[model samples]
Target: MAQREVIVGSRVGLHARPAALFVKTVSAQPVKMTIRKGDGAPVDARSILRVLALGAKHGDTVVLEADGEGAEEALDAVATVVAEDHDDPA
Candidate 1:
């Protein structure tokens, strides 16, 4: 398994649109991914509900983990997304 910690940059955190976008990105990967806040149990990264349930606010640090084929790439992609400020105008 590969894991990385990232600080969320979205103003609204991992909720609504931000969570949806993160889920969509992770769902496209072949590897299994999970995310957790602090010492909490990791939850499926591809599930918007699960990601949102983490209540990760802006500036909060979260851990992203993935395993299986392309796990490192998957983790890197998701971590980049999670660290981005999705709430900002594109």
Candidate 2:
């Protein structure tokens, strides 16, 4: 598995909008991915509810993990989504 720690950049953290955006971003990747906050059990990066439940607020550190072909690339992309605050909640 590959892992990366990213700080929540959005003012509201990975809440509704951010979480939704995160889900969308990771869902596009082919490799399976998991996200975790603190020492919490990793949750499906593709699930909005699971990702939101992480309660990762602004400044909080979260870890993303993946195991499969191109796991590193997939994790990196997820990290970009997290770090960039790329959420379009409607």
Candidate 3:
């Protein structure tokens, strides 16, 4: 298993569009993943509702953990998504 902690940098936090994008990214991974915030129980990273339910506001630190063959990569992708504010400037 691999785990990483990242802070939500988006001004609006992970709401609506960003939340959807985050779920999509995490769910796309083959590994099992979970996200936890502020000592809260971890939630499946693949579930949008569960992620949002964590109430991870802007600047809040979140812990991401994954297990399986591609766990590290999966966590990295999630970190990228959150760190980039789910924005792709392409």
Candidate 4:
């Protein structure tokens, strides 16, 4: 298993568009990934609903975990997505 803690930089947190973007990114990965807020139970990173249910706010630290082939790369990709401010113009 691979895991990493990252602070969410999205101005709107992991909701709506930001959540969708994160979920989409994770879903495309060839590994199972989960994300959790604080000490809460991890939720499927590929599910937009699950990710949005986290109610994570800007600057909130979250833990991303994954196992299986390419787990490290998957975790790294998702972690980067969560740490980015999607609200800002790309």
Best by lDDT: 4
The 0-to-1 C-alpha lDDT of every candidate, in the order given, reads 0.89, 0.85, 0.85, 0.90
Clashing pairs in 1: none
Instruction: At residue 46, give the lDDT of candidate 2.
Output: 88
Candidate 3 residue-wise lDDT, 10-90, digit = tens:
667888778888999987899889999978898888898898888788899999998889889889988988876655445
Error of 3 at 11 (Å): 1.0
**Positional deviation of 13 in candidate 1, in angstroms?**
0.4
TM values, all candidates:
0.93, 0.89, 0.90, 0.94
Best by TM-score: 4
lDDT of 2 at 10: 78
TM-score of 3: 0.90
Candidates' RMSD to native:
1.2, 2.7, 2.2, 1.3
Between the candidate structures 1 and 2, which one is better when assessed by lDDT? Answer: 1
Q: Candidate 2: deviation at residue 43, Å? A: 1.0
